[model samples]
Target: MKVIVIATAMFLAGAASVQAADKVTFQMDWLPGGDKAAIFVCLERGFCEDAGLDVSLETGRGSSESLTKLATGSSDIGNADIGALMAARVTENLPVTAVMSYYNQGPHAFFTLRGNGIEKFADVKGKHLVTSPFTSSNVYLPLVLNDNGLTMDDITLTKTDPGALNPMLVTGRTDAVISWITDVTRYTRQVEDAGREMIVLPWADAGLVMYSGTIVASDKFLAERPDVARRFVAALLESVKYMRENPQDAAQAVNDAVPELDHPTAMGSLQDAIGLIFNEVTERDGLGAFEPERLKATWDRVAAAQGLDADALDPESVVNRNFMPEN
Candidate 1:
């Protein structure tokens, strides 16, 4: 009888432990690709499991779309552009907050083929540019143009499906296409395959600095499961560190998870992604840290572009720094 009772207690304890694992649905801002290698690495390496999480990945139509999913509680967390999150907060009054910034330097940029005569930001004037309406780049184009001494009147803007932007540019239907700089490796390969040379004009270079990819959660989720959010961030940063330290293995892990991804392209994309993840700020403040001044600058610029009152929208309300891990 004593042995049976001990066995039953052990079984019940194991069952409770299994039931305690948090179910976290992580929505991606785009399709599963090389850009999301770090998240994939975390999932593949059992880091999330070790952190007491049962995390799942969902493909998102775009960054704004992902934010919508988080706002509606469809996803527990999401990786999205900070600009889009700000726009959503101002326009829809969503209670979503970003916790960790993965892309300290925003990836928004314009891609043009060499010899297109659009060598500088000023050259974009009087040229044809294609972009998707949902892209963060298009959403922030006004600010980018204004900062560079230009405006929408200076360029002919064409709206198209995200898939069509690259094709339209490569086929001469447009002079350039706006996209994320992280897509450089993939798009450059495509252009080279078509016998064309690709040139990227980064928004950061033109003084349109902002955070790009970040981990965000709805207010309800954070309020209810703060521990889970912290664990998720910790596991994610661990995966990022592992990825940075072991590029080749990390790339392989990504390719293994998403078999359709080309190994070499995955490696190159991860390398570029890492470059965006770390900088002097991240070095000094630690990874996943946000400088209040930098956040305020980005928020002000985004709010101004959207014609919203920057002072009314407190940056701290949009971002909660309490969730980041110490190391």
Candidate 2:
């Protein structure tokens, strides 16, 4: 009789423990690819499970769409551009906040053929530029041009589908295409296949410095499940550290998670992604840490571009550092 009672109590406790694992629906800022290997690494390695989270990932179309899902509470957490999130907050009064910054330097860039005679920023004048309406780079295009003594009037802007940008550029339909630097491998391969050499001009080099690829959560989620949020952040940071140490293995993990992803392309993308993930700022402050001054600068740029008052919204209101893991 005593043994039976003990066994029953143990079984109940085990069931309760299983039930207590928090379910986290994570949404990416864009389609799944090599750039998203860290999330897959954490999921496949059981890091999220170890942290008491049962996490799932969903592909997103763009930062604005991802932020919209988060703001509407349709998704628990998302990876998006901090600038886009700030714009949404200012423009729409969304109740979402960025908890972790993975990309200290934004990946936004403009790519063109080396033979296009566009060796410098000034060379872009009167050139036809192709970009998707929803790309983060497009959001900052005005600011990037203005900082370089140019404006929208100086260039020909062609809004097209994201898939068409690469094809249009390779076929000589456009002079340049704006996209994230992580896609350099994809774009480079296409340009090379078309017998052209690609030249990349990152926004950071053009003086449009900002944060990209941030982990965000809706205000409701943070307010109600702060513990789960911290655990998720810790697991994510752990995966990031793991990827930094073993990039090849991280790439393999992503390929394993998404079989359709090409290994070589994924590896190339991961290599480019690592450059943006860890920088002098990340080394000094720690992973996922955001400098207040940097955040303020980003806010100012976004406000200037979007025609919003910089003082209308506080940076602290958009960023919540409480969920970052303790080093």
Which has the greatest lDDT? 2
> What would the per-residue lDDT of candidate 2 be over residues 73-146, giving only the tens digit for each residue?
88899798888888888789998999999899888888999888788877899999999987667768888899
Model number with the top TM-score? 2
**lDDT against the true structure, each candidate:** 0.86, 0.87
| Local lDDT at 116 for model 1 | 91
Task: List candidate 1 segments past 4 Å from native.
Answer: 1-17
Predicted candidate 1 versus true structure: per-residue lDDT over 154-219, tens digit per residue: 999999888888888888999999988777888888899899999999888898876778889988
Q: Could you give the C-alpha RMSD of every candidate to the true structure, in order shown?
A: 2.7, 2.3
Model 1 quality (TM-score): 0.90
